[model samples]
Target: MVDILRADARVGNKTYTSATVVIIGAGISGMCMAIDLIKRNNCHNFVILEKSSGVGGTWHDNKYPGCCCDVASILYSYSFEQYPKWSREYPGQEELLKYLIHVAEKYGLYKYIRFNSEAKEARWDEEEKKWRISVEVSGDKDSQFASSYILNSDFLASAVGQLNVPREPDIPGLKDFQGRMMHSARWDWTYNFENKRIAIIGNGATSAQIVPEVAKVASHLTVYQRTPNWVMPRLDTAVSPLQQALLTYVPPLRMRKRSLAMDFRESFYAAVSDAKSDFAQQIREWCVEGLRTQLANKPELWEKLTPNYSPGCKRLIISDDIYPALARENVDLETRRISRITETGIQIEGGTSQEYDLIVLATGFKTVEFMYPIQIYGSNGRPLSDIWKEGASAYHGVTVEDLPNFGMFYGPNTNLGHNSIILMIEAQSRYLNAILGEVLRARAKGKTLSVRPNPDALKRYNRELQEVLAKSSFADSNCSSWYKTEEGKITNNWSGTVVDYQRNLSQVRWSDYVVEGSAKGVVEPRKITHLGRVREESYMSNGSLILTAASVLAVVGGVLLRGSSLLRSR
Candidate 1:
């Protein structure tokens, strides 16, 4: 019920603004948080600051060709907000973007999103128990240096995912490439690849889709591969008009469709968790057979495209057209490592050289680096990056140990190899909403609060998670992948299924978090918990009373029945 926030002090003639909650990024995580805050909590004293001009986070930024989700559309979306009109099974980038826009509009989230506002620094103020957030506001032509503003907030939430920043490989003379250069993440759609000899570097997840799509139009295509990936056929199909109509008219059908899709995805978790499992071998064989069937005549090509590591070690690519595209006469697979990039072409090992009009860096983004470009200082001004110097680890993959009242979706070890992350995100948003509710109550009483997981608990949780991951294919594959850091630790994947994550985050364990607030020092701490909306003792008393009455009634009925039977026997 507390809506008022202490006003921000004026700095350099710029009036700073303060909100109850300041969510960073307008991506799926941020939007989900915003919607939960408004709809469930009926709290709206928040703002979502996005670096991009539009609402869709990655979908808004990466406008590359053949961009589509690896997960199915029905399950990839929020369970509460189902889209009845997904055009494809695995929707393309544009369609996905459109879906996001539709969701944002439907939820009336546009007014809450502040676009082109990039967060620069967020420092926790211990004394004030608030976050001093510095943001760079672009597109302000009237103001010099674009506009640097401070956002003071009672709580800070990060939906800024780890995958947007594109990384180019460290190849010598990469700058010397005089031909058209582009990254798959930062795709240049305007620059024509049609009728041009194009070379794609790094045959990973993004390249798996880009290669085949580009081959359909490029004059010639060459893929430079260091390590091959296991690619299974994508069961992609267009949604017929009848199906779309059924989904639109019969809303429950979407839930059923998502449940069926989830079942298919969940069945792969065993294969992902245990590399030596029968299902894992079957997955490997499926990839091998897929290659053999597509490149039957070109046995040599199959050998080159085959992966050397376990199937789930690296992210798998699902594309039906990849092998067929590679088998084309104009398409060439270069397994040899690149020696250097020339002005017009690339030189490979053994003195082999090739010319191409365009070079596509299909390299992926920094996955282990959480919240890059934004420096966050937690309690006591300890830098978040420094605290996570070894690797990023979070309790329940949502809250870190030192970061108080700051929650993140898709944090360390939350990325699922088998199931859709939307499921995980839904659970996380709900959990964070509970934490926010607690914060709001404290603020309503004119008190400050800082919330974080206990250090011992986080350490134990992460240790158990790492042990589980050790048996998973990602750790046993013996291949360097984006899932790990330079230390070769599995930091990007969850050791369990999405359902596991959901059940764990279904409710906030108030005892698990180390709470700090003004009420504890002088006044008694608030006995607030979401356990059936009643005190623990009260709930136990009601249950015990009901059980006692039931026991007495059963005893009386048994005596009466015994007496009647004795008389009848006589």
Candidate 2:
């Protein structure tokens, strides 16, 4: 085994004006990747490129009423770093944003992040062994790149997730609508809905969140639902101060809580992956019973609210508030087909027209197109958009077949229906940390290295994944969701359990990839290092890149061990 740097070991806090590694976004995934690189890999020569004015990708962007995380707060947070004092079981967007900002502050990440810097294009520099990235920022429009900035790096990590981009439904006469309009993702906070007749369209997760809260305040809330979703009651409660005290005093207690939450969340795997299982049937009953119990007063709701398909066919919504809110006198749930947006209001298919002062499109994101509009040119000048013309895919939801020295966070087929995505991100971070260490280590040795998995390996991985997913409710059940591609392929989710993903990304199989260096052809990353001894992997050699000896620490598991956290999860 190659001697590697011990994870969690204290490394140099050096800063690089020009980064050797460039991360696309400063969101949760990007921050996690950067922290791992600096702390675990002992490399600090990286910068995060963020388009917004601050950190927090989805959390910062979405400030709509009742916007929050559905996953349990304790489990959703970073395992290694936990904020045990979360106010709720599931946190609101503001609280989540605060958590991300706190994480950045704790790790000293503000200096390394360039806010308002949006990546436009990335092209591989075959000769230079680097990526030439173009970015657009607030600058002189008449500049060299026409208001865009240039950044060059040896490696790139696309941490931009699929949910950020806002999409509107294509309805006839949309521009003719005279009322104020906005999408859920881009909620207009300044434009108040108080005493305003609000027509909220779409019934996805965002809609489910907004309807309940908006109904309480709006003069009249009209929700246009095309499909009914299987719902699970959320156990959201304020965290008691005593509980916070216990969590603060007892670190292991918080760990146990997180583990328990994860276990409970993971139980849904059967419902989504193996819909015919007993547990899946139990879940279906629970959803049905819960809806019936909540809407018992208005028994007529069973006809309007009940879904036709199975529970796990579509994304299972977790909300304890939706039923009561929709059942209110001022709230009207209309299942009629929307004909078009008129100058004053909406016209239903039954020739009925309802006028409203404002229209809130609860329509969710365009999730199938991963990293849209961001042009990434791989080897042989093949644009990533052209390659993913059919759909987006990756070897292990991280590395693409020909995108050498490039990786993505929250890429295709990586979204989870059963558990937290933060877990997947951490696993991928460690995996990428290993590869990044190898690449930079090689560069310090006066060698330029390029890395990517074999084409056959990537193909085999995705094919096996699709075959297994075909049996699941996500593919088998007839329901339209953000999970599928334009071609109706289940392209947005992981078919396997969270533990499975954790195990797969635990280690980077050196032989599975193809790597070459300028000075040394077929550069093998395997090296000589002793886990039981002391050494440093890389260091400054007279202000130039140079590989230093590896230093080891006495960890419970050996240094550079893969999937240690995954083992903890088990």
Candidate 3:
């Protein structure tokens, strides 16, 4: 058997001196990537640069009223770190944020992260085979760092997701609205809505959540909806203490729990993928039943609220009792077109004016705008914006053409519709680790590493992705959604199941890349380090023993079957 200490020391020798990887975001994806790198790849020379002082990514950023996840709480977390202690099925923002922080702490990932540092630009240096990243500290006036502070690794991973930019509607006289106005992404808590007339723009997830919370105290709530969404009943429940204790004591039990959650989530993939099927019919019936029960008093409201487009075209809203909130006497759901905004309120298409004390624009994020505000220059000084001027295309939604030694997490078409993105992040980290492993091997042999996907491969992959998306629910044009760009291109979501993505990334195709380095090199001897070896050995030994016991039990079952047959013959 290979000496585990020597192997780890060898791996550490390749990773200790320089950062082999730099993850740009300290969100869930970034944190997962770091854990995978350290535990699986034995890589310690990576850094996570977060623009904010803390982690949690979107959960950390958006703290608007009634903000929570649309995805079920059970399926929203890392599969390996299942939290059975959730207070609600669709956990509130603060709870989700706390979960992320807990994960970071458990993994001891705080040391690998730098807060309040934003990546300005990343340029690939052809000669050095390293990325030249420009980062600026938020409060520093002139503190800038070139490539002077990076690990010696040749790979760059951008976990800075596409949905970070807040999208402001190009409404006429939006800036002139004298009443305090703010985007859902940048919620202003100081502007009190208590006993105030509030007009909320957009009936998406944010609007749905905010409406109920604001309606509780607001004098009157007016919801401006250009298109009505298909809101479904959310079967949310709090996790009991007994369940939490079981998860904490027996980690393997959580795997069984996650499997059940995944099974339910996978059913939605089929419903969304084939919108014309029976599943879609069932969803329509559910929506109609919900409408009939909630808007029974006003049949006219039901007709206006019914969606003409397919259920999957846009994001499906989840609510335990949103219809009841809308039916309240103080709540008003207007399906009118906005003509313009006045100083104190809004003017509708029929020239009707509605007054309000505050306006909240839950317009969603600028998802189509990938890596905005940051200018990226690849080899030959070619800008990424110029390359993807028409539309963005990436190899496995991680690597791009002409952008050597750079990998991105949650890149084009990698967003999921059915499962937690933590699965995708783990898969990507494995794929990236394979490539980096080869790079280190080549370096030890005195060769430089260069990995790029074939043009034909990337073209075919993206073509299939777009084709699948065209048939999916997000492509329905009856209602405009953030999923599509200005040109009507579906550039945000992954069109297939998480399993498909995982299987595709299971192995790296060497033929798809071009590696450069000296053919001959010498391995440097280094001091032995046994970090995490004892824990790793304990787990591995237990797993091996379990497999051995299972094999023996299977043999015993066969022998017992044979003896039963002999007894029956006698």
Candidate 4:
């Protein structure tokens, strides 16, 4: 229940503002942390720095055609704030963005968010015992007050999750292209693709979602595939009015929907984690069935579209349209390696050049490079980039060894392969909220506090984590994924299931962190009871499974009674 907000200090031309907490992003992670700060910790003195003009993080940035989530809509959203009226089973980018905006407005977090403020550098001040963040503020053209300033905070929470920065391929002559070029993340909707030849550079998940829509409008579409991906059928269906009403009125129906998706994803862990398992083979068959069946007529493109590595090596793609789109007469699948880009188009390895009117780069993001382009210095002026020179590692992917009073959302090894990341984010939010609450308590008593993960704890945790990750399909030597570094270290995905991550972060282990100054040091471990809220609602008293079954029976019984009455009348 402590609030500290001041802007009294000024040195030369630079101004300094202080806050109890500073969250660097207005995405789901940052918003989740802000809401937790308000509800859990009762702390309101925080500022969220967002580089974009709006919220939604990745959803806000990537506004391409046919862009939608692979996960089920019911389970993809926040557990507490459920949306019963999703248009489709798999919601698109706009719907997701609307959900985020609605949540932010409901929580009244807009007052604390600085839309165009970007954190460039964050350095720990040993003397001041706080984090001094160098923030650069930029405004749109025709607007004034674009400047840079210094902000100090008692605790720094980096909610700038991965997938923010778009990665363009390092191909030669990329700049020499005279035609219109754009990355999938930065789509230009204004440009008309009708009756124009278009070339898509990558065939990953983003491209998988984009190809279908582009193929419809373009005169001719060429998809440049370096390596094919495992694609399963997306059972996307419209949520009818009846279903929406049931979800809205009967709360159990909504819980049941999420529970079903969660259970299925939980069972899907073996498919991604252990590629040799029966579940993995089953998944492979489903993917193969979808691919072969969709492109059955185009036998020539079968081998070209088949993956060389295992199904789960790279991120899995769930789409029913990508294959059929590629099978279109105007669409061509190019498996040949690209040599370089020409002024007009792309040149492949055999010196075969193809002209195109537009080029789309779907080369994804700099995922392994956690928090890149933002220099962060911790204890002893130790650079965080240098510390993670080999690979990024953190204790539970939240607290680092030397970075005291700092927590990261969706950090290294926290990304999920089989389940929704909202679960993980909530867990990390609760854990960080506990630490920040301790900081607030210290501040209430006129004291400064810093708490960082114990080096030994971090080391041990990562050692065990890497060991488990080594056994996963992501460690396959046959294929390279964005999950790994150039030196072959897995840094992006969690080694276990979402449930495992939740259990690991369910308790705040005080002994695992180093406390500084006047702070709550080691204490008996306390369980965050609310951490079990989601699972409890799914499996416990609500009895989502039983309710789901009873609801099905009720509908069946109603139909039978109606049928009997009709027969008697006849």
Instruction: Assess every candidate by TM-score.
Output: 0.89, 0.88, 0.85, 0.92
Model 1 has an lDDT value of 0.82
lDDT of 1 by residue, 378-478 (tens): 98999988879999999998898788889998889988888887777777888888887777777777877788888988999999999888887888646
Q: List all candidate RMSDs to the true structure.
A: 10.4, 10.8, 8.6, 5.6
Q: Which residue window of length 10 is worst by lDDT in model 1?
A: 531-540
Q: Candidate 3: lDDT of 407?
A: 80
Task: Name the top TM-score candidate.
Answer: 4
Give candidate 2 misplaced runs (Cα > 4 Å): 1-18, 139-146, 519-570
Ordering by lDDT:
4, 1, 2, 3
Q: How many Å off is the CA of 444 in candidate 4?
A: 1.1
- Residues 400-513, candidate 2: write the lDDT tens digits: 877889999999899999889898888788888778787877776667889888888888898999998888888854677888875778888998878888878766677678
Which residue pairs collide, candidate 3?
18-152, 19-151, 312-473, 313-473, 445-521, 447-517, 447-518, 448-516, 448-517
Residue pairs clashing, model 1: none
lDDT of 3 at 391: 86
Candidate 1 lDDT at 161 equals 79
Residue 319 of candidate 4: its Cα lDDT? 89
